[model samples]
Target: MSVYTEVGRDQLIAFLADYAVGELVHYQGISDGIENTNYFVTTDKGEFVLTLFEHHDFGELAYFLDVMTFFFEHGIPSAHPAADRQGRYLKKLCGRPAALVMRLDGRGVANVASLAQCEAIGDILGQMHIAGQQFQSRRHSQRGPEWRQETAQRLLPMMEADQAALLKNELAFQKGYADLDLPWGVTHSDLFRDNALFDGEELRGIIDFYYACDEYLLYDLAVAVNDWCVDESGTLALRHYQALMSGYLQHRQLTDAEQANWNLVLRAAALRFWLSRLQDKLFPREGEITQIKNPDAFLKILQQHRHQPFSVDELQ
Candidate 1:
């Protein structure tokens, strides 16, 4: 079910020759991404990441590419999609869309163990949120209430009747408490630590913009809080949250409404990923190498958020 075509090798070589001639002699699947097929193309010029858009909307993807370009120009560390000779940010390959980008310099650290690392990520994300306001294109959140209802309906066919009911109940919980007054803007909906890269003490780049969309800005912060402040066991790591919130507030302060609504937003963020992982497990897309994330991780996150206070003092 691999979407890649060996037929494109010669054409790819021809294309790269213009931008990175005599550099890419070998290319192989890195296979790290859960959504797209990524290959690390090595050349005498340097390394680059070639990504094939898979099971994702091309229009949204194009918007994210423009977002990356804007962030990169504004001193945010990110991989801007490379334009082709015709000045196209996107290129057609083997009947699918593809893009080439400069390889980020660092590796994705599985955990943020140091306060400095957490603070650095928070600062960078704050900068991104500030800069995101400048972007004109706005995409509605993909996991909005309507999306949850539709996905639950689709998932019902694949799960036990009881499990489907449980999903419905969770969906209700989300809808009843949904916030209408939270700040809305572009967000990297998937801001897990794995999507962030670190080079020494510096945050080298944020990758994987496929999930970027217009949503509650605090939802983005909530996603980051869940990632940086939770241990593998799902317990709250208060110090990590402290450093992250401290650095984040240095750029933009959370409004009282945003703070008051933060806890449920965090729960909703947890529910969002939990439902996505469950759906992916139950009804995986064709041509996808389907592996489900640990749903318990987010469930634990939900539990931890239930008791945590969302006071200004919490922003240490």
Candidate 2:
């Protein structure tokens, strides 16, 4: 989360008046993500995260908060929102929608995830997908198919020839499976390594539900696998892949259709991140970023998926 909006001590203290979080001791801006402003907030009462929405409005954020609540209620290890004295989770802060969530334990492993960490991520994701079956409300991703297509088109003009060709062919291939009926539910849509926290090999919690939406459950797993189970060079790590799948299967089993489209799902997941990172690179956002993600990483991942394609069975 980028610190787009800066909150002064007085401003934060005044805002905390609505809640019972006690007097603020200190707060520091968190610059790990791109879409939102996050600060590690501490008070006499407890530690929490303060998020100022950059792209989403008050109304649009309700779904994400509700999703957080749902996950919390379902015993999922996720960041849960702290309600104000008035029992409201969504509130206003410095002219933007904001909310405070109990900060989860542990640090992000990022690109150094081990085999056991991969299995933990997969197990938790499987459990989340299963619990999502009970979710009554559904919302399509803001970054869904239409947005991806439009983004790819916009980025094509700015891409190298090889990249452009790969983008076009992948989009065409992905379009064919758009209507395929696979196991679908609430998806964490962006469960990269940084989004999940770990205390050593033990998973503490999954944070950043901002990208959570209704989509193919398998796609969610693929997104996690892409980030958590890949080597530095973007190649699949066999031991990690098998470990992840093994953990996932402990919670839920895949359908025949999901198995049939497994490799394609992996490829689709690769393209989505590649296109998004490319878009971010070309149309640079004006902000202070802790680290801007590299598009070339996803490019390499996509190329690996395409050239050395493997089935779910192979990975398992």
- In candidate 1, clashing pairs total 3
Scored by Cα lDDT, where does model 2 land?
Answer: 0.87
Regions of candidate 1 where Cα sits further than 4 Å from its true position: 1-8, 15-22, 156-166, 176-179, 285-291, 307-316
Report how far off residue 38 is in candidate 1 (Å): 1.1
Q: Write the per-residue lDDT of candidate 1 for residues 227-248, one digit (tens) a residue.
A: 7888987776888888988889
Model 2 alpha-carbon drift over 4 Å, by segment: none
TM-scores for every candidate against the unseen true structure:
0.89, 0.97
**Candidate 2 residue-wise lDDT, 134-162, digit = tens:** 99877887776787799998998888898
Whole-model lDDT values for every prediction: 0.75, 0.87
